[model samples]
Target: MRLFLLLFAAVFLPAMGSSKAVCHADVPCTLGDRSYHVRAPDDWDAATPMPVLLHFHGWGRQGDLIVNHGRIAGHTRNRGVLLLAPNGLGRSWDFWRAGSRDTDFALAVIEDAAKRYPIDRSRIYVSGYSYGSAMAWRFACEGGDGVAALLAISGTIPQDETCASHPRDIRHVHGLADPVLEYPFGPGGDPRGAVRLWRDTLGCGAGETAPDYAIRPFLTLSRTVWDSCAAGGRVTLDTHPGGHFIPHGWIGWQLDQLAGRAPRYP
Candidate 1:
C-alpha cells in the first residue's frame, strides 16, 4: 500500500501542479509542468477584473522571450492589460492540424491564470506571430465565446477546418513581399482564405481594402475589413509593403483599434 501510494504521488501530483509555490511574469509559470509566462501591469488589482492578451510566441521562441519583448509588453502594460505568453510544447505548436491538444492547452493556460488574478474573460484576446499566428487561428476557432478577438502577424490558419460558430473580431497582418510564409498563401497557410473563413463564419458583409495609408508612406499598410458581422465581430486584414514581419506600430494599432481610437472600417 505504501509503495503504491508513493508511486502515485510521484507521478500524478507533478502532473497536477507545479512544484513551485507561486507563478510570476519574471519567470516561467506552470500548471503541472506546462510552461507559460505572464505579465501584469505595475498596478495590478487582484480584486478588480482586467483585460488580458494571451499571446502565443513564434516558432523556436519561448514564452519568456515574448513577455520581455518591448513592443507588445510595453503597450499592454501601459494599457493595464495583462499579457500571457504560453510556450509551445517543445517550442513548436501542433497548429498544422485542427482539434489539436495545443488548443486545449492554450485555454487551460487562461483558466489557470484566472485563479491567481481577476481576469476579464469577455475581453480576452489571443495573438501570435508566424507559426504562432497559425496556432492563434486554431485557438480562436476552437475557443468560441471564450475568445474575444485575434491579432495575428505574418501567418495564417494551417487548414480549412470548420471554425467555431461564435463571432469574433479578427485582425491579421501580413506583408506583400513575405518570403518566409510567402505572399497570400504558402507553406504556412492561405492568408486571404483564412480571413475569408472568419468573414463567412462571423457573417460579415463585403470586404473593402481601404486605400488610405497610416504611418510612414514608406511602410504604408493596406487595410481590408468585413463589417456588420454577427455579435459585432469584424475582420481586418492589414497588408504592409515589407517582407514577412511584424510591421512597425502593429501592436499599438491593434490596441488602438480595440479601444475605438483607430479609424472606422466602414
Candidate 2:
C-alpha cells in the first residue's frame, strides 16, 4: 500500500544501519504530537534481533525521564534489552477500562517498532509503577500477542473491570505498608484479585509461598508463585515489609528471572 511505504521510508529507513537507537535519553522519537523514549543496550549489534521492554511511567511523568533512571536503564543495558517507554497524554493514562487510548497506543507502538528494527517479538515485556502499573494490568487484559510478560509495582486494575481470559507471565510487587496505592487492596482495586484474575486464567493452583524469599541484598520478600497452568503461564507476587516503592535491584532482577537466568523463587 502507498501508506505502508511512506511509513517504512520514515520509520524503518532511519533505524537501518544505525548502531545507536533511533530514540534515546534527551532525545525522543516523535509520533504525531506525542513522543516516547528508548535506551539501547550496551554493545548492541545492528543486525541482531534484540529483546525490548516497554515500561509505562507513572502519572504526571514522562517516559524520557524513566529511560534516564539508573534503576531501569543500568540494569537492562547489560541484558541487551532495549527500554521503550511511551509518553502518556497530559502526563497520565486512561487505564481503568479496556480498549482505552493509552493501551491501544502502546500496542500500536509494538507493531510499529517491529517494522523499524529486528525486534524479538517473543520477548516483548510490559512494566509500570503506580498509575502506570495500572496501565500494565489493563494492557495485559488487552495487549494481545504483543506482550510477553508484566512487571507491575504499586498498582492494580479497577475492581469492576473485566479482562480477557488470557494467560500471562506476571510478576507483581507491592509493599504491604504502601499508603499511596496501599497494599493487597488499593484505591483502584484489590491487587490480590488482580493476581487472581491472571492466575485463574491460567488455571494455576493455589499459590505456593516462600515466606522469606530474599532476592535483593538486604530486603526480605514474601514470594508467591503459581506455575502449574496451561501454556507455561506463571504468576508471581512479591511483597516486602516497606511502603509503595521499588526495592533496590528489583526491576532488573525480574528481567533476569523472566529470561530464565535468575531464580523466580528461593
Candidate 3:
C-alpha cells in the first residue's frame, strides 16, 4: 500500500508542482497491474476535468518509445490535459482476435484515469498511428458512443460488423500514397473502402466535396464532413499525400474540434 501511494505521488505530485513530463520508461499507470509509458502536462488535475487523449502507436513501436517521440505530449501540453500512450501486450493491439480482451483493458484505463485525474467524460478522445489506427476504428465502431471522438492516422478501419453500427464520432486520416492501404479500395476490400464505410455510416452525401487546403511536402491535408448524422453528430476525414506517418497538425485540429474551438486553416 505504501509503494502504491508513493507511485501515485510520483505521478500526482509533479503535476501539482506545475511541471510537464513526457515519460519514455515503464511506469505504474492507471491500470494497476499493468504499467505503460505516458506523456502529459504536469498540471494534470483530477479536480479540474480536462480532455484526455489516448494515443495508440503503430505496430512495432513500444508505448514508452511512442512517448519518447514526443508527438502526443507536444499536442496536449498547451491545452492542459492528459495524453496517455498505453503499451499493447506484445507491442501489438489485438482487435481482430478473440481472447485478447484489449478493449476491456482500454476501458479500464479510462475508468482508472478518471479516478486519478480530473477527466471530462464527454471529452475523451482516441487516436492511433498505424495498426493502432485500425484498432481505434474498431473500438469506436464497437463502443464509440462513450468517447467524444476518434482520430485514425495512417491506417484503415477493418471490415467487420462493428462499422455497421454507424459510430458517430470518427475522423480518418490516410496518406494518398500509402503503399500499405492503397486508396480507392472497393468491392474486394481496401483501406480507402474502409474510410468510405465510416463516411457512409456518418451519413455523408456521396456527392460531398473535400475542403481545399495548402499542400505540404509529401503531404496534403484535406477535410470533409458528413451531414445530418442520426446521432446529431458528424464524421470528418483528413487525407494527406505522404507515406505511412502521422500527419502534422492533424491531432491538434481534432483536439480543437473536441474542445469546441473552430478550426483555422494553415
Estimate the TM-score of every prediction: 0.83, 0.84, 0.79
The parts of candidate 3 lying over 4 Å away from their true place are: 1-11, 14-26, 30-33, 42-46, 97-100, 164-167, 187-192, 215-218, 262-266
What local distance difference test score does each model get? 0.74, 0.75, 0.65
- Candidate 2 lDDT over 107-195, as tens digits, reads 77666566556789888888889999888888888764457788889898764555673426788898888899877553466445647
Q: Which ten-residue region of model 3 has the weakest summed lDDT?
A: 16-25
Q: Model 3: per-residue lDDT, tens digit, 79-184?
A: 6667777778778888774334666677776776554556777788888888888777766766667877888887765443435343447778777788875654
Candidate 1 lDDT for residue 109:
88
User: Which candidate number has the best lDDT?
Assistant: 2
Native-to-model Cα distance after best TM-score fit, residue 46 in candidate 1, in Å: 4.7
- Model 3 steric clash pairs: 15-42, 19-42, 45-118, 46-117, 46-118, 220-241
**Which RMSD does model 2 reach against the true structure?**
7.0
Give candidate 3's root-mean-square deviation (CA, Å). 5.9
**Tens-place lDDT digits, model 1, residues 107-210:** 88888887666788888888888898888887887775777788888877643557764436789888878888865552357445647667767777777767
Clashing residue pairs in candidate 2 are none
- Model 1 misplaced regions, further than 4 Å: 1-20, 165-167, 185-194, 216-218, 230-232, 262-266
Candidate with the greatest TM-score versus the true structure? 2
* Stretches > 4 Å off in candidate 2: 1-14, 17-22, 165-167, 185-194, 230-232, 263-266
